[model samples]
Target: MKQDLRAVIIDDETNAREALSNLLRLVCPEVEICGEAKNADLGIEVIKEQKPNLVFLDIQMPGKSGFDLLASFEKVDFGIIFTTAYQEFAIRAFRFSAIDYLLKPIDPDELQAAVEKYKSQTAGLNPQQIQILQQQLDTPGTVRLVNRQKNDNQRIALPTAEGIHFVQMTDIIQCESLGSYTKFHLIKGPAIVVSRLLKEYEEILDNYYFFRVHQSNIINLEHIKRYVKGDGGQVWMSDNTEIEVSRRRKEEFLSLLSDFYVNSGKLK
Candidate 1:
């Protein structure tokens, strides 16, 4: 028999908790509702007392937000599936950190997917990664990405067949689209194919100064070795991969290159 996965729902509203609990009851028979809490304080207490294996945490509460709740914990041992109302920034942040989340008015399909993802990530998160998630939430505005932090090891979480792997953003030379999957080429690692679209990764990596020179490719701006003008354009990547830029996207790519070079003081 499959063991029931214990879960606790932490939300500020009674309706929200009840709705999710009921939804889980209908869709997932393996999930056992261990307890529920109305706020982060009580949520922490329930977490300590019940010690459920999974927590469905609402991002917004009366006093302490979801980020605040996570900050309170010394170490997050169990799985967390965040529930939030749609904020463009929040959505991007979640993708950037590769965290599982359920949007408000949640669909059953998405709920099931989130649960499955949590099951796969049984090991959960460490303290520093958790802190980065907090940083992601607070970060939304676009700024020219610079390697200002000398000691910062900026990595993006990628889900693979083996498990979740964190790849340094700077190490990634380019990304290629394969229908629903996006394959990443890193500096010294084997190519990794993740179950996500190129556009999704493009959105998350663009903020970190990656550029989409083609519909099917997103290359790190710092990894362009040379550009050869063609019908549209061709660029040689640091790893020696050649990417094609569409004519329509050529101007945008050139402008981005201009900005990137100027920002990095490579161009006057």
Candidate 2:
């Protein structure tokens, strides 16, 4: 037998909190609502008192946002499921950080799915993952000025057999597909192999400087040392590894690289 999941709902809106509580009672009988709070300050108090296994946190509130509430804790021992009215960009950040979130006007199916995911996963979002999410949410500009702060802030969460690894996006040279698994070749460390499919990562990395030169390979444009031309050009990565660009994708890859150089001001 399993234990009931003790949960706390924290939202500024009374209706939102009530709605979520009622929905949980109906959809998730296994989840027990132990506490509720209207603001971050009261939320902190509720969490400390109840020490629930999970928290359904609303993103925007009167005094502090969900991110601010998380920052208050030195270590988050419980799981989190964020409730938000944010748009696509924030959704992308949540995906990139592997965090669980439900958009406003939450659908029952999605909420149930999120709960199932939480039950299956070993742990919830760690501090590093939260930081990555916050950073990605803060950065809205497509073309940002190069700086150490930006580089340090840009990280993605990779879940492996060992645990969830938070890595700087700039450190990744390329991603290689090994059947269902994806291996990350980094600039400063050994490759990290993740259980997820390559296509999933391709979608996330595409928003950054990554380009899929082949079906099995996605290279970071910043890590391209040289491009050797051929029927399908081969690019030498910063790791000194040569990767072949697919014949069908060669033209598009070149175009993207040219655009990258122009936009990045690296065309000297």
Candidate 3:
């Protein structure tokens, strides 16, 4: 009554590759292991040839790294689940990319969960959003635009090469709401003004990386330095900025933190 999902495994180590393939076949029999690649180049070739529905990607490889390989591709037709050996920065980068990932010495349960999440998210994804996600996977960073007011109309222009100032999404500490305007606090330079509501930006940002921790603040989970608990809960950003977690959003925030750490395999 269900369909089989085709998958390919890409890892430099033969043992790891085979082990993952075997595990998938054993636990998730519905997942067909189409092929395996020992390096990024070969993996890309196989992916192009097989066109599987999913890919179990390894972060590190011989010639090109997983990130490099992903960047080279113009489009990603398959869902990706990155497998790595506990690199904190890479994991954070993947989180920012809004892609599903798993830690090395992979657990069957976690792998299953990742697959399920992928299925749900991709089911109703719009073509534009898919394109945006693919673009972000290849080139990850913050986006800025200019707003112009003429008469009673407003026009927006994409930041140009001459006027362009690029900031990594991870560099964003928090977004502050002032009246109808939102100010972005970055790791460098002055905060920029954009004529958009906090809710608007929140909707644009991929939910896997950013969370609405409070009514006025949306914090990047990767930038959270610490979580301070007291009469009310608060999160400390990498820049030493504090953000309140509203009582209404407390449970959801805690659940996100729990899932993040759990998926990273810091918790059993």
Candidate 3 residue spans exceeding 4 A from truth: 123-268
List model 2 lDDT by residue over 188-234, tens digit each: 86899998789988767656788889999999888999999999989
Model 1 Cα lDDT, one tens digit per residue, 24-95: 999987899999999999999999999888899998788998878888888887788889885777787777
lDDT of 3 by residue, 58-144 (tens): 876778887667766776666777787855444434432334578888889988887776665534222333233344344433322
Model 1 TM-score?
A: 0.86
Q: Whole-model lDDT for model 3 versus the true structure?
A: 0.66
Cα deviation at 185, candidate 3, in Å, is 10
- Candidate rank order under lDDT: 2, 1, 3
Estimated TM-score for each candidate: 0.86, 0.86, 0.49
Q: Which 10 residues in a row give candidate 3 its minimum summed lDDT?
A: 146-155
For model 1, the stretches where C-alpha displacement exceeds 4 angstroms are: 117-122, 126-129, 142-153
Superposed Cα deviation of residue 266, candidate 2 (Å): 2.7
Clashing pairs in 3: none
Task: Highest lDDT: give the candidate number.
Answer: 2
- How many pairs collide in each candidate, listed in order? 0, 0, 0
